[model samples]
Target: MMLLALALLQAAATPSDAATEARYERCIDLATTNPVAARSEAGKWQLANGGWFAHQCLGMAYATEGGWSAAAVEFEAAARAAEVAKDKRAAQYWAQAGNAWLAGGANDKASAALNSALSAGTLTGLQLGEAHLDRARVLYATGDLDGARRDLDAALAVVPEDPLAWLLSATLARRAGDLPRARKDIAEAESRTKEAPEVQLEKGNIAAASGDEAGARAAWGIAAVGKGAAAESATRALAQFYAK
Candidate 1:
């Protein structure tokens, strides 16, 4: 799961004026550096009519503290407040809420928030693509493969440079028995970064699916030495392959 606190921070839009922007920036900085203090300050600010930006900072503070559900609530509140003011930031807040819900393992709520974000039609560029990518993840988790595929395609169209999008597209294609597309998309991902363990693991999986055991072993060898879940998975795959 891509629990992206930094991405949420980057998505923060400029406030209406200079003072509001400065305050938001300070709160966000505090949220990252000292979440407890940020949360307290943001709460007081919210009660003092700090508006949507206050809720946004509060959400960031909660996220930094690993309070995904609370962060989601704050983001949702920010979205509603932005909507009431007809602000473009509403879509961004909805997207943040969806991501927080996803991080919290609330797929149903994530889907709802993502739906609102997409329906707003206000998101553009990479933000729009990321929103689609996130929705695709939610759909895939819910067993809606077709929906996931559609959203992935849309994401790829908008963010062709995003290796994660290509990696996911490749994985989905491999799962759906579309080896040709899997190969193409994985190549796109690999071209972007051959060092990524997940990319290497997926490359190994695709190679194994194609009956290329040697190729699989080579890729898995690279992945096994890397870190995190992908490395662990690659190690297991090598064991299973050798046993077979």
Candidate 2:
């Protein structure tokens, strides 16, 4: 173990200061359309000892491919490397690790990793908001409705403009039988953003929860603006929900 540690320590890293800048160039190129390739490319730096940057670039790559498992590994590695390097802002990597774990089907582990991330510091308001969003998603998936709601509310309190936070909050509100809150949040999101098919999808979700098929259809039509995969899924959900 000591030998491996030494090797990890001595390994010719890709240089911390420059790794992020370089990886971002690669990430933007591959992630826009070729996610799988992007992931494989990003994974190359895992053993390079580049700290949080390598992990972040790689995390985006895996997220693009929906390969949460791989993303979790990279993010976890980044967190450890950052901690060892005493990078005070390493909390972001830890948060990414937790999010990846949650996305990868490791619930308890995700929470634990996130706690480690939070230990780093309160970080910026945006970072705190993201932490709450991640925790809420994990808890909601684990069937902890109350916990999810708490996190969502905290996230909204910090950064209400965060689309994902609003969408998740609205979902949880609908689940908690707070249709008015759900509709309000969804409407607020729609009013604030013209892009992001997800905003429309969540609005459709709100309509479906209210059993308003026409409303749901109208919301989905707005979502189909980009005619992307997200839009298709929203259309499919509306179809299925309204068919009943």
Candidate 3:
């Protein structure tokens, strides 16, 4: 499961001066209608202003077309520009760069950007939680389970209501053989978001761990109807269950 926080970041990464906001709004509109032309316009704006917002617009244009690597480059440029200007928004730009890097599956680069974001000491509340969660993902990918778990704990403390945080926490707890914590965490995630296939899949796994075959079957059946990887996983689980 992934954090939904990126959409919020994308909405307000730039400074909120009226003129800049107007330009950013136009950039958004044009990005939806014509991404190529939006990139062109943003490129010209960058040449003229060379401000963080210009790079933000360029990132937005690239992101519209699923160009994650290009988007990460533009967001890193925005971050560097923000740093040069001593803007507090540098943290957010770096976080956005991390998100783009994560989307591109460049976990090492994502970790670097996220580290810069956290080191900025400007993020608070859900933004801080998101950064921690992203770092946890990188740590988990790199087999640093203890570090990943610590970050997930930090993320949950900051954003307890986030279903994705709970889901990942549950997964990590289960992997570490903390079945009770896994069960509790997945229950919390289920309460926050009932339709999440990852939650359901985890619930099934937790039930299986507890030797509750019926519970496992029920949860997996529900999860199998979902779209994407979770559904495929649930289907495989059910097939394996019936095979035995």
Candidate 4:
């Protein structure tokens, strides 16, 4: 989601004219409001030599339509084009490609793209932190827990205010059997957002692991109030707890 948000914010590469800038802006707006139209507009622009900006918009359009693999291809193409032009935005495009790949469940491709982005060392601040976080997610999915932990630590160091980073770090800690770390990280996540079901679920897990059945039950109850995967998982956890 963050990556998608970033894509929406992308500006054209110092457009040669105001008209080009306006066109790019319009295409990006269409990407969010009407992805099908955006795709057609971007395709036309690309045929007219819109370069990396056109590819980037096309990627955003695909992403908005939930076409993750197509989005990744377009983003990677944009990154390559930017690189050929010696543009600093190439790193950002690579990061976007990695996010799309991750969304498509292609962890290997995600890892490679993210590695390219980070290795460039052009990203900074929140962008840098998010790139690390995305790579961590890929690593976690691929069962490279230690590598994921390292990347999560890097992300937390750069973006301590991000609740998702804290939540994921807490989840990883709990999975690694580091209850104390889990509790600490989850508390940080809770401070940022007390009502998130995922945070509450992690809290329940950490509490359960610490042998506090009542605390776990209460947290899971809070988690179960919502609908979706987290709530379903909380319900299952509650069922198991009751059985015990």
Candidate 5:
């Protein structure tokens, strides 16, 4: 009968819902480390549910990998769905939209989305920290050094244990011609995260600035294992140094 068919449809939809949710979580995880794989699986779910999480993940895949155009589409879709969800995840979508805008070089869009994310009031502590960090980076890129400094300060105030704020502070200090402060901050950040090769690279920068050739070489060697693009260039630097 019609009623039996309706009940069966609802039953089938339940498992599909669970599977979609699982796929979203998987996509978020894989997107960071292996975006191609993440997108391949996530695209399948997007064909069905394509809800906030799916759009957000797709957006993240583009933003993080520097594919700005594609990121904008997914992030905008995410923002729309997130507002409709009216749930905790809504703020996250707002942040993603802002980040994608920043990646896309659409400064105004980034600012608006970031403001909305703050206003939404659902961001987790870590999410808020990351948002501040990103906003600060964008501000710096746009030559708003004063604004960038303020945001970095705010992020550090919120999460003193996070090494990234310290790292950013060091870079900012160096750019501002405060080598002493840069050295001190970079040293602290490097000391905090011994396992992170990027920290080693930061330390290497400080060492080079201070003319500690041996120390810089050692740090750069460690940093060569990092995922940063500079890793390859750093290896070349090392090769040139040894060749000398």
Candidate 6:
């Protein structure tokens, strides 16, 4: 997942920072339409003592190009700079760094950055919820199922409307043999939306676990026709069923 960029430049509070804010906005504006140029601009700005915002702009530019590793590096630098400046947005920067690190396939680094963000005690509401959710992904990937479950629960508590959190909670509940909890969460997910392939796949998993073979097959079949990682997973699930 990509980090949500702050709209800091959208409303500058003082004239002294107007020029810097305009430059930051320009860098962000180019990230979508001309990321290469944005990167070049950010590099120049950084060399000109543009400080943390320059690194942040560079990170956004790299993220636009799917250069995850470079984005992570820049985001981490920005986070550190934000912290040193005693900026309230430091937690958000750390969270963004964590997300970029995860995108770069650095789970350990992601986990550490996420920890820093959470420990900052500054993130609130959905932002904090999302941080917990990403940390859960890292924990799950590291085989720390218990830790993942705790984080997922925390995420759901803060963002009950998040279908992904419910789906993951259901999947983990099922794996832990808490069928009742799993069914409840999966039903909640189903009520929210049925368009996601992963949701369909989880629906199938719950059905299969409950010995409802036909229901499982139906859901998985729908999911298998979709694209991306979820569809690939659904395909593997269907193959396993047929092989049995």
The candidate scoring highest on TM-score is: 1
Task: Using lDDT as the measure, name the better of candidate 1 and candidate 4.
Answer: 1
TM-score for each prediction? 0.94, 0.67, 0.92, 0.93, 0.65, 0.88
Candidate 6 clashing pairs?
none
- Per-residue alpha-carbon lDDT of candidate 1 for residues 71-180, written as tens digits (9 for 90 to 100): 99999999999999999999999999998888889999999999999999999988899899989989999999999999999999998888888888999999999999
How much does each candidate deviate from the true structure in C-alpha RMSD?
Answer: 1.8, 8.6, 1.9, 2.2, 10.6, 3.5
For residues 1-244, what per-residue lDDT tens digits would candidate 2 score against the true structure?
A: 0000110111112334575766656654675468778666666765665456656667666766777777677777777877787875467777777877776779898888877876777456766777777787789988999999998888889878766777777778888889999998877666667466877777887888898988888878778665667688776776675578
Give the distance in Å from residue 135's predicted Cα in candidate 1 to where it truly belongs: 0.3
List clashing residue pairs in candidate 2: none
How much is the lDDT of residue 229 in candidate 4? 85
lDDT of 3 by residue, 1-244 (tens): 4335563235545456888788888876786678899899898888889488878778877887879899889889988988998998889888888888887899999999999999999998878888899888889888999999999999999989888888888989989999999999999999998877888999999999989999999999999999878888999999987788
Candidate 6 local distance difference test against the native? 0.81
Which regions of candidate 1 are displaced past 4 Å?
Answer: 1-6
Candidate 1: residue 116 lDDT (0-100): 99
Model 6's TM-score against the true structure = 0.88
lDDT (Cα, tens digit) per residue for candidate 6, span 18-130: 88888888888897679899999999999999878888888888888878778878878887987898886778778878877877789999999999989999988877888
Ranking by lDDT: 1, 4, 3, 6, 2, 5
Local distance difference test values of all predictions, in order: 0.89, 0.70, 0.85, 0.87, 0.69, 0.81
Candidate 4 Cα outliers beyond 4 Å, as residue runs:
1-17
> Which whole-number lDDT from 0 to 100 does residue 180 have in model 3?
96
Ten contiguous residues with the weakest lDDT in model 6: 6-15
Candidate 4 minimal-lDDT segment of 10 residues: 1-10
Quote the lDDT for 107 in model 4: 91
Task: Report the C-alpha lDDT of model 4 over 1-244, residue by residue, as the tens digit.
Answer: 2212343234435466798888888998998789999999999999999988899999999988889999999999999999999999899989989988988899999999999999999998877888899898889888999999999999999989888889889989999999999999999999998888888988999999999999999999999997778888999999986786
In model 5, pairs of residues that clash are: none
